[model samples]
Target chain A: MSRHLPIVAVTPFPAAAAHELKDAQLRANLGRATRTIRDKRARVVAEVPDWEELRERAARTKDEVLDRLPELLARFERAAAAAGASVHHAADAAAANAIVAELVRAQGADRVVKIKSMATQEIGLNEALAEAGITAIETDLAELIVQLADDTPSHILVPAIHYNRSQIREIFAARMPGFSAESDEPAVLAGAAREYLRRTFLSAEVAVCGANFAVAETGSLVIVESEGNGRMCLTLPGTLIAVVGVEKLLPRMADLGDFLRLLPRSSTGERMNPYTSVFTGVTPDDGPRRLHIVLLDNGRTKTAQDPVGRAALRCIRCSACLNVCPVYERTGGHAYGSVYPGPIGAILSPQLTGQDAGANSSLPFASTLCGACYDVCPVKIDIPEILVHLRQTGPKPAAERAAMATLSWVMRDRRRWRGALRAARTGAVPLRALTRRRGGTLRRAPWPVSAWTAHRDAPLPPPESFRDWWRRTHAE
Target chain B: MRIALLVTCLNEALFPRAGMAVVTVLERLGHTVAFPPEQTCCGQLHANTGYAAPARELERHTEAAFAGHDVIVTPSGSCAAHLRAHTELPVYELSELLVDVLGVTDVGARFPHRVTYHPTCHGLRMLRLGDRPQRLLRAVSGLELVDLPEPEQCCGFGGTFALKNPGVSGAMLADKCANAVSTGAEYLAAADNSCLAHIGGGLARRPGAPKPVHYAEILAGTGAAA
Candidate 1:
């Protein structure tokens, strides 16, 4: 709660990015974590007989949900209300944060327990709650480590992925009482965290969690997790508040079977998650007595309206896409500067937030559109298509725009391509001067060409185009 | 068969030898290769850069250029991939034609150097021609093949992206080159000249960077021609 949020005014762009890239320890930590998870996921996925079929089904189901989103939201609201749950609608990030803060105030609670949730992270909800004088304690083990260390989560499933066991031991020793760097084992760390969070779970009057899926027909909120900490957060508090994005809703309860089957297999590579929690509303003796569901729009409606970009909403957050993404493998999650990371994040964040020129703008170009994310996506969001669509909307540098405009003309006419080829062939000798000579590789260039030369060598064109040779031999 | 060589715009103006290599390989296989002069760029640069309207206009010109050809062959895998996915015509990257379409087991080409092959993103992911290029490259005589770490990762020569986000793009390219260097190969070869041009250009500038050769050039045994 109060501990989780800290305001950093500047959006993470060139400055933050350059600094992060320079840290070798962080890079090593992230690389190890992501590779281990990625390899494990691949092995587990290989065992499933109908994995491709399940992916197709999951994709189709998500597409169906997106098509009738408004209707589904209405249905969810009615069913949730009928089950004695009050639903709140948030039009933007600010609205969602304010709604959550107001709910915290209404409960008259100074501290609360929070389950790991990206939607909360996206709106900086914890920071807002802190501003309102309420403390939010992140109960998830990885999230707690991140909060305690005052660091952003680097991976979606593993928030503390950028920290190794030694790093975690150091953070715990500094931040938590009765913790020591000498006790760096997983069991020791888990024991210390369990002891710390136990008090928060019991003492906190209200609990906040994010739903993995919200069923429209039954008003059921579902959470799938490997750790049982989520279960404690959901049941221990007197009041429960769930903040979910509008795109989280699925059309029917039956659809959950495909997703539940697809998600665990694709994500953590488990046939089934260790803990599965589902609730329609506050149960008399089973869980929290008071239930509140905040259905946050936050630019989802605008994304849903896009013919090409809307498909990005189909993500189940299984993070299978992230594991296979090459870009994600190298740059890591923090480089993305969004709660969401990897391929799905590249497409989803831009649409959800309208590609703001800062961090959001850079997201669209983050990937090479390698399509690995699309291939692995259980929901088949066509991540590459949305990436291209968002790239169209994102601002381009002045020189780039002009160059692209000129290239467009060359592409639109056959004569222009031929003419350019002819020009290159005759000037190949002089063009060599444009190249910088190193031992074996070429060196840097001036402006735009320097961009390529900065990293690799520029290829030299031969003396003739294919058309010239064909005409000389075949006379076609 | 009437074969129309779609010498991709990059191959036309920047790497004509790649286009020539495609022709030489096809003709050596006993097919009459024709270059439809009216053919231009695949409009991928425009399409990828977010100028779809003009890209569509280019697409129209391309559709007209090789309208009646029985098959279209290209040295550039990315261009062939773009056409396979975006255009109505049947298109093949030169490597695909050598193996899948032409059924040629041996290319009769030789390259003695240790080489690493990059699975250009468009060919591997977009067009779904998985592992075919590597198979063809392996068939060439005297070629030592090594695995490229993260072979499918993009080299970041995403047309205007290189210019737009120069810093990130540069970082990505550095990683790509580092991976190629890690293989300790004498050369890095790929099917697409557009991506090759970008990577090759960068490798050329490295103090002791191994050269990057196009797949067509390797298959045609023209590594030293330039």
Candidate 2:
């Protein structure tokens, strides 16, 4: 993606979030859904006494991969090739999409049965395939609902998480072939999707998926899913193409222990996911006759160049941070305006596409820096620190810059600070009318200060400051 | 113990009572509390708002102001959190100073009002000042301390965030205010006035809402028992 492209955010976060906040239905859906997931993750995470240790080890393992990324990629290619899988390297989104589309065309297949994959979504692989006159059917239930409704996936884990049961029922009725069930029961809706997707899976010739973790030592790829749709996509096809992000590598097969333990609990809050598929290259007369792995690097190298911003590469797409985030809870994922949304999206999307690439430059300020993201992060990404670091860099308005300089200058020396406070208290005199209704707090003011007063009352400065009181009482 | 008071910028100006109450509580416990009048802002807002140059300048001024103090204390956990990282001087939030440093949960002051505590983000996460403020509050003889539901949730006064993204911040504040009001509390006590002011602002619009009081204000209470 080019820096000029609005790849991360189409609209600035404030406007988008503000718009999202007005939708009472969306807020109710998001509130109930995130609360359920947050509570579930908390319960299962508490069961693991070594949760901290697991997080530490996972972080260290990811750090090692980021440190020696080139070497591990080479090692993984060697192992996968030895096991009869072809590996392709793509430096950016266009190159990756071209590669995948060409492969599908080479097989003379105009349609592919696909499992839900963030990498494919990131590269716009589906759109690219559509441009090539190819149809890709989504097998995952949530992905299918979103596809049917012509909507984008909001939350990372559940693509249609913003939709309640009734919403899904409406989508199924309109979009699914011969879906007549009007009851909003989840089981009834899910059963309809299963029947439709089973036909798609059985008749599919080519399957496209994404790898959660790639084992460099064993030349194997792992995909963790609650639905068995991915297992069907992996086995029932003659040709398989897997799009793997370069950051999704483990140095050794043994390293999977910590992640397997972490991913399930931190994600679905389950002891073990219903489906855990680990496969090497093609097996003769077995899973797939041919295998292709595309190691995609769409701005990962650029992200890794910055020491503070690089930890976002460790994300396993668990969505725990999103569920726990106050901002995400209020606004949901579309407010982020990216394929990834929420706290991790606020950091990862900006870094991956560059802060200036989209309206996402506002992403850093999207959080209150309350730090719930850091506490729930399975990889210890330290998202708040990175968010602050991002804020410190890049383009800032000249007026705001000058204002900050003036404010900090006024705050430097005690004489200046005391004088500034006195001046502000005196300034609060004419503004007392604005504060009267709220009792010593302004209900409205100017541009930025008005922003605060719009939602919460802005307090008027007291006639006597703490230092002034201390000088009279205790400062001899 | 001689304590250096770092009354944060917000409290020093708008919420001086919170700062005054902090001093009152410390002195009542028989410790000398010092306020270096030269102290100003902790540069947290500047640092967070992307003005690195200005943030550094304020950090230098604050460090110079608090230098040579054995221990520094502030009523704001958010400010104390910044100081703990940026300054060489030891810093503690007030409840931390009261319970951890002095080994005293009971400050010997009594307030009979029902109070609920909102643990500011920095104290709960960064400083890990878990239950210290609650312990001190529980020790207040006549105080009936009720719990704020989902007490870990932020009040959304993310400093500049409330101003920059007022819509989302207001929504968050609305929920927090509802939770605090649902508790039937007379006072809502918290470690940071920055948050208190934001939550208080939301509560102010609601009739018969609980008064926003700092935890130290509750601790400094020396009135007839209710």
Candidate 3:
């Protein structure tokens, strides 16, 4: 099952989605929330006249990185090292987690404050740290909400989006000490979280954060955040460890102009993020003394090897695709059962874990290929193209493969195709009584059509096929 | 104009009426329609389901079916889009054939019913069929084209996607149906039959569901066909 690979899909997408579909609360919460975000994104994106151009620029910049990732990574390492930061490379999730854990242990720190970073989540870093008897606290309001409830994030941009205000208040009332909720107001919740985290951030010796974009030339790591909690995590701690994905790199600092404009609009639907922390290295008096940049590859190099799969590495974890995805809106992120979710997750997680890696094999088929994700993508990731590509390469059930083969064989020739149609017509003879009761629709049938009929009805063929009708009427 | 009809496999086997409706609309527009029987399906089902080889094979047969035809038209937007992807053939969805190729928005047909149009995903995103189908629907003589909320959202037909992930598919279908029904339309008309089939099936399960009809059928309805 590749149990240690936290990014691999643990449950088949369909199986997991089926279970989540039954959760009416999750469905309702995600539906309303995603639709709002979708509307906001559209509105804000429309305000920018050069949104498309910005996306192209950002995509081109990321492509440039992919084309010479090795050179760029090496250059980034040299630049960061020159700036007094120690750069470490971890080949896999296990190695990344261990490196981060060892670094944390070396700091002589038992507790570490965190900013919500997909890189850490991808490697199960907090879980690894817990096993080492170290505590990692989530400082972001939404991240804290999910952390307190022991719940995994449902949305990437707004991780605890699945919960309502009342739900958040309840979590705080139960988990947060010296907390009495006056109401389930946004300001009230923020005030409570801020009050609790203020001391934690100041007292913590080490903080773990994630990078939004890293410049190879400047050796700078950027964190684009809305709440500014990540800002606190960047500056307040004595030692800072930024877990960064290898794909999160740009060749030059000039690329940040377009990205800064693209990320907030595509992600939180804001024209500008409140806090953007750029850490170049250790500063003597301003920030942390010891800086550690763990460049985690995990499956990135493997993903970058495939021409079709390499485009997914351009994703900046905006979660815009999630809000726009029909599948994601209904099932939410948890249904993906992976570190990442939604359209990007469906394509990226599978490639990250290899096409044959456990349940991730089914991740590619988790989409309807609606192209909503592609339309909204800030980096112009051809998500549907990758989804289809992965599906073709990934494992298939013997029955489905046989069915496709048989159908292909029959469809290869006109005569056989017609024969199959005639077969289908004759095959429906026994189901005539059922269709009659259902007003000329097949409501229930056998194997292939079984799942289809479980909720939706199937149409019955006419007395004659269209080809037969055409042939009989026109004998030209 | 000699318009070759590639009535998709789904329409050929199950909904031949939709194919006949295409012929009716084209012929009414003073165009000769040829039924190339060799074309069974466009292989959108195969391609979307991960069987690219079979999909390409079907595309070859389809290309051969209408080999020398200048303009190929189909009732289904997705099938037309899928077929258009593989070959350079002038494959046009019915809406595109009418509004763009034939240079006629009104197909001179009517169905006198409260109808809501759904812009299926492929037609909306892939084909960029934006407002072309809806513009044609608006020109129908007696058809009252009602606006559907979130019309661009997918109906969740997605061929085998309905079966492969029935729960999510059913949920999407339910929401789509709710939006269609909310418009209080007698029929939910779309450019694609495959999508209509799914929406129809979902609407069929509901007690007071709106009947699902292809826009071709609505355009083909000349009072008597009603």
Candidate 4:
């Protein structure tokens, strides 16, 4: 069960594994963080009178972008090259990683500083770089803490959200060469990370980043962050490499007007990001003289091919949906077992990697479908809609499929529905008796029914479905 | 006005009092509340748990049941929200009908206890029936409405989810129950009976007193002393 808290294991087979999430601690952290973010999001969202209109526009714009992604990629490449930049196309994670590795090798740099990038984490870029004998230093405070402790990110905005200050002190004390455990304040923690990575920023000749928004018309990459570390990474390093999903492209540079306003308020609850960096290719001798853009397919085209599911590609990666998600609050990010977490991950991971990978198939069931995520999403991606769409695409357990098929067959005609209801009532007595000890539908049954019984008992299939009663009494 | 009461399948089967309460409130307000006998399950359980293909049939059935009604009201907020959220039905949670349609906030009922309200998942988020229940509950004289912490969080009773993932569901219910208890309230009230039933079951076996009650029972003039 302790193993279940991580949910990161490649399989969901061990049914009896005790869940390790501490109820009290998770409730406390999630309650506090979610409430704070939700309230702030509501306030900021309310400020925009045309918020719904903006959401509609964003959704339509993204749909258009997805349709033209191949052409947009070419346009972006042309514009980027015109701005004195090199663009590389990667079909998968392996190719993306290799592109970054070759860029790092070409720069002849032993170490590279990095800003917080989900693309990097998604491809396990840091681990890959380490294997290639290249050291990548994470500069974002939360990413730095996670990197130092060898821990996975538990939240999109706050990577160390699962770990409180005290837990962080322990990690730094053990892993960081010189840091005291008593420094629990945010400033103190920031200082500790800054002090450690200060040298890497100055010495490293190459840097890696992820694009929040990529403009196809101008061949521009934009990064929005609260900390100045991202700005420093883009500026200090002589060579810069950004590996972005092919779906991240926007049609025009002017479209940033809507996203620039929406991203901060939805994500950090601020009117605007503290540091908004937009650089097109290379800028002479100012920042990263040599810039490399890696356009990654990485299963995005497959996800885009889906009509209903493709709506997930419209996500701005604001993390607003996560902040308002009840399920994400309780289980944390590791439970999703993907770089993308919360409501987005539930729909995104399965489409991105095919539902069969690891526990990605289980991700759709992780959400409560409460609709808070849909309400808070700035781009108005109906996450629950896409979640159900993905569920339809994934392979269902055999027993469940069989049960549903039987139910469908029975309910297809009124006569069969009545007959089945009457038939089910005969077994009600013993079924009710069994439900008492078990709870719900859990009983000694067939393979899948037994799996349900392992946890909870099944309600007696209601002595009769409503249709049977309506017929017996109402038929005059 | 002729109002159709969609007594969700759970109401007809498990807890009829909740449905009765809605009929009582609407009748008192000078409206005829009709029960469409053909009404049954909303197929929310099937749709939410990944059997939405079968749910489409149930959806068509539900829409057929309440086709010509002037207004549709249901006692369970979660179920009502499900009807509105999942299907294109002009449905209202009982509180919304009372306040929005009937224009009755003060029902002249009295329930004296510090009651904390747990708004069900679909009610708060999907239906957007915000503070309507609290406003109605506040009008009940002597009722002290204490705020519930994280009132919007799921109580782990997601219909089949409680039965399917009992341990995870129990953990979530424990958190909700503990939060309700932390408020030091005498009763934990909510607009949805399914959630209350789930939490009420947990509290019944919790080895503690001050078990929560459904909001319908309270609004129906049955308080702690009833």
Candidate 5:
């Protein structure tokens, strides 16, 4: 929503990751939380006999939405408006922020209760609201923790995943107006958050939310959550403003059945979340008196144009990919330098902002391409494939470009390849000498290639390549 | 059947022994193996690193290298996957070639050692060589195949990923090594040597670590060779 893209990493991924690695406590918290979620997801996911088939269907459904996105969005806007809700289209993040801030001002409310929303985070909506003199209060427990500490959300589902229970207890005790300084229990923390937000929720005149899915056929917007805070925010406010990415549309309401099943299981590893709230425009004084939907297209249209990268838009923000990611487990979300982090963030962030948008270029290289994220993604988004596609199309350092060009030329012919191998074997001689004391492996390497040797030893190339061996042994 | 051994550029240059082992195992099973000298790298390095033009060129070259062979087999799963994606060649990972194509789970090899298998990311997820390597290891007499805890996790040898994200890569490799050590096996075996090179390098730095061996080397070994 801010015209400015949130400052992506000022430092590249490796540097940020290295700095984060020194946080032993953060790593421990992430390791435990992610591992538990990983196991839970695997267990429940395995229970479905037709899980793969369901994934395929989900993927196909999203692809259909993408193929007919313009039509579906038009239908959704018509239905929402016919049902008495005002629908606003935003071309970019700044436009989205301006629209939401103006809407909040129109409501004449100085404070708004917020449901946890990545779309809002992606747009820097809270900051925009602050600039407009409106206080956006986050109701989700993790969101509350991050807001109270004046810190950025790290993980998507659990924004404060970097903090253990004890750390969170300390935060609440220090920051909350009234707090017993003695408890570290998760229930205690949740209770403290509930009490802290209850006052804000009851008195809030305007509420801003993000929809998980917007049904075009039925003109309904849905939000699924574990805590009832989202429910309270949706039903209690006089004015409701839902800012959702355009990609959140489904062709029909029945499509919600598949997603509802997939989203909870994939996200929290639960059979079903505790609360699911669905609403259409202006429900006759029962809910908010007014409904406003800000349909945001901050580079989504461009992302949808990509044949391969467009599959990333199918993401339900389940965080299944993040939970199973080895790199995310190590570096945490901060290293990715985006609201969306881990495998999904690696591809989605770069595409949403354009690959050349600041340090977003570094996001694609954040993963090991382990394929775990792809396997766990409910929509079957081939995240690794998209990462590779972005890397090919994204800007590369000039030296790396030159080296790859030279290598490509050298690899096109067998004769050149053999020659390169001979040269490499010769180069290995000096490297082999450096490793002689450390057995047959080099523990450290010189500049440019030093990255490989920093963590693991490199085995020196053997004296004879198999090509040469074949020529000498069998060819003779 | 005559099989052309598409010893990937990595195997050809660094782990020629793995290539030789592939040849030895196939030949022992009454299959003729031919080394296509025209073959070089699979261009995975170029492809994965965002150099698609070179990667495509290398892909075309690979397709030409093993054009007329009855079957193309490679010991490296990552290379085979890359080539398969780019070309119509009937490229097969060594385990797939043995267990699926040749219909031989065991190659009558005997190695009396406790070994744990690490399924590389390409082999495990890309090729979905689910339990095929395990099936082959089970058939090898006198070989003890111990299960690797969290075997599906990547060793972080993502070609250039190791260099680019050395810190994260190292952390992952440490977890992998810890799991391998927990298995209490004397040897760690996998289909892809590139991963072994990465994992083995880490093991080499630590005292009393399991020796990383390629599955081809394990399958090719006879009791006498051991």
Candidate 6:
């Protein structure tokens, strides 16, 4: 296992979110992109009469895969090897990166093109390849934009969603040699990226990619994308290395049918993505001559062992949760400080790295638990349930734990609860005095309570609680 | 039916009028509501803030407190949802009780004012209390129930979330308040007072904005002139 943890936020989530909230441009860009994508997803999803059923089936299928992950992985490995592909097991990020770097070096290729892969990003493979003196170029438009800008990806599907068209234009002009300065149109920008990467794609001897799904029955790997970059990277290279998370496996090839229908509409809001490249092992005279599959466990087994949190592994990286998340919509993805961001990130990152993984433990507390992410999830992950589960299992601050312990003792008894309530009501007298100037609302509070009043006004506790009123009125 | 009122912790301490409205409306409908003094909170705050043991204790207290009631009704959808999730009780949000159980869309109340309803996230998504509150509001005599733009979006009260992630929560509340204001409604109503507190707090900051009112308060009105 890699002792090196994936990049986690040095600053906690609340502080990071507060910082991200100060940037108006980033928020506007995120708001527009998320709203557009959410609307499109809703429209496309509405077209399917069996969308709910599809979601249920997808959830069930994913559960079954989790239930039999070890067996299915073995099945997949055997089938893939039989199809003339070399299969490698990576216990963690370091092993995966080392394997891929070695593969690239053996091919005598210092430069390799890439498809947009969350798995590769998770393992920091690009940086590892660079350490081995190899240049890995991102081919997907969004990934390419983020790579060129030398920025960390914020959103999963749309890595550079924090940047608007004009910002992207600026990055392209400053970074790409011979790029037009005035063109800000999306098509224009896309054409520039295509021109920039076309030669690299043709001349590259090796490609590093991630698989959206790995079928255990047929030894087939699937890559779904809006742009044709995934197709180019998958086919043009002489040697193909796919870094896949073990959770991305399906029991059979036929299972791909349901996911194919669910993923596109849920993701890019397209009824079908522009490109879906599926390859089995290696082709004799076509496509990549040699294929290598690196199946990574990086804390996946631990997550799968958790009955409540295991559902998080069902995610297909659709970004549906991110689009619908009010917290994400406000703070943008940088606040999450993980390769995964938004609601899914809130659960997935913490579990993948384990809660004690420094600032990553704060991820579970990042959401309002509004359940928007749960409602929009294609696989019915029940993200709120998982979040709460993770919170129970994760680390707790000593003060909070002590407070809860005291509160639990009080709440278990009616007399103690009423006394506590009376004490709280008496304690609020000063707060009430402060709020009297602003129509019985406190604009600011002190210490622990200040977290609330800092942003919105808080209501003063009534002179009499409902219990007091009930006793006074109904005592007779 | 033996109906017990689970006046949520927030409603009990801050907006007691909303709890009173629930009682008045229920009494007017020929039902005697019982106040199980043993009932304190649904433990939503504790549970949501990553304190599961205390939440479970509160849940056990609630389950024991309202153990024998044939039905338990609360004005807050979010609290009722917490109860439904944690306890094996027939807990209902006010609208669900009136419309689904009692089969009365018109609750025989009236408020002559322009009102927009913000479907708090818990009621809309968790309980799926779709159109129940709206149908009741529509039946009220001389009340204009205006449409709130993005009614489905969260008000961002989110229990501890309002405090922990105040910036994002405030941003969400600002958008919600702006949407409520755009409807030109005199009153903004929702099933949950916690949401109203946040939305109302933001509205109060803006001069001449609509005041936040609990839906039960509107339903408890009797064609009275302001």
Could you tell me which 10 consecutive residues in candidate 4 chain A have the lowest summed lDDT? A1-10
Better of 4 and 6 by DockQ: 6
Q: What docking tier does model 4 reach?
A: acceptable
Write out the backbone clash pairs for model 5: A1-A93, A1-A123
Residue A459 Cα positional deviation in candidate 2, in Å, after optimal superposition? 1.2
Per-residue lDDT tens digits of candidate 6, residues A1-476? Answer: 33344446667898999899999999889889999999999999999999999999999999999999999999999999999999999998999999999999999999999999999999998888888899999998889889989988999999999999999999999998778758798889988888888978889899999999999998999999888888888888889999999999999888899999999998889998788888899879899999999999998999999889999999999999999998999999889888899999989988888887869888888887889999889999999999988888888889878987887787788788778778878989887877776678777778876877677777777887887677776676
Give Cα distance to truth, residue B1, candidate 2, Å. 1.1
- Every candidate's lDDT: 0.78, 0.89, 0.87, 0.76, 0.88, 0.88
- For residues A1-476, what per-residue lDDT tens digits would candidate 2 score against the true structure? 33222247889999999899989999999999999989999999999999999999999999999999999999999999999999999998889989999999999999999988999888888878888899999888999998899888898998898899998898899989989997999899989999998888898999999999999998999999988999999999999999999999999999998999999898888988889899999999899999999999999988988999999999999999999999999999999998889999988888988878768789999999999999999999999999999999866779889989998888887788788889888998878766665566676679767777787777788777777688789856
Error of 4 at A177 (Å): 3.5
Separately for all candidates shown, the number of backbone clashes (residues 3 or more apart, or on different chains) is 18, 0, 0, 12, 2, 0
Q: In candidate 6 chain A, what residue range of length 10 has the lowest lDDT sum?
A: A1-10
| Candidate 3 chain A least-lDDT 10 residues | A1-10
Regions more than 4 Å wrong, model 5: A1-4, A427-438, B222-226
- Candidate 2 accuracy as lDDT: 0.89
Candidate topping DockQ: 2
Per-residue error for B30 in candidate 2, Å, reads 1.6
Instruction: State fnat for each of the candidate structures.
Output: 0.65, 0.88, 0.72, 0.16, 0.84, 0.73
Considering chain A alone, report the TM-score of candidate 4 relative to the true chain A.
0.89
lDDT of model number 4: 0.76
Better of 4 and 6 by lDDT: 6
What's the ranking of the predictions by DockQ, best on top? 2, 5, 3, 6, 1, 4
Candidate 5 per-residue lDDT, tens place, A1-476, comes to 22555535556788889999999999999999999998999899889898898899999999999999999999999999999999999998888989999998998889999999989998999989999999999999999899989988889999999998888888888898887858788887788788888998999999999999999997899999988999999999999999999999999999998998898889999988799998999878599999999999998899999999999999999999999999999999988888888999899988888877778888889887889999999999999999999999999999989988987787778888888888888989977877777667888778866777777777778888887677776774
Colliding residue pairs in candidate 3:
none
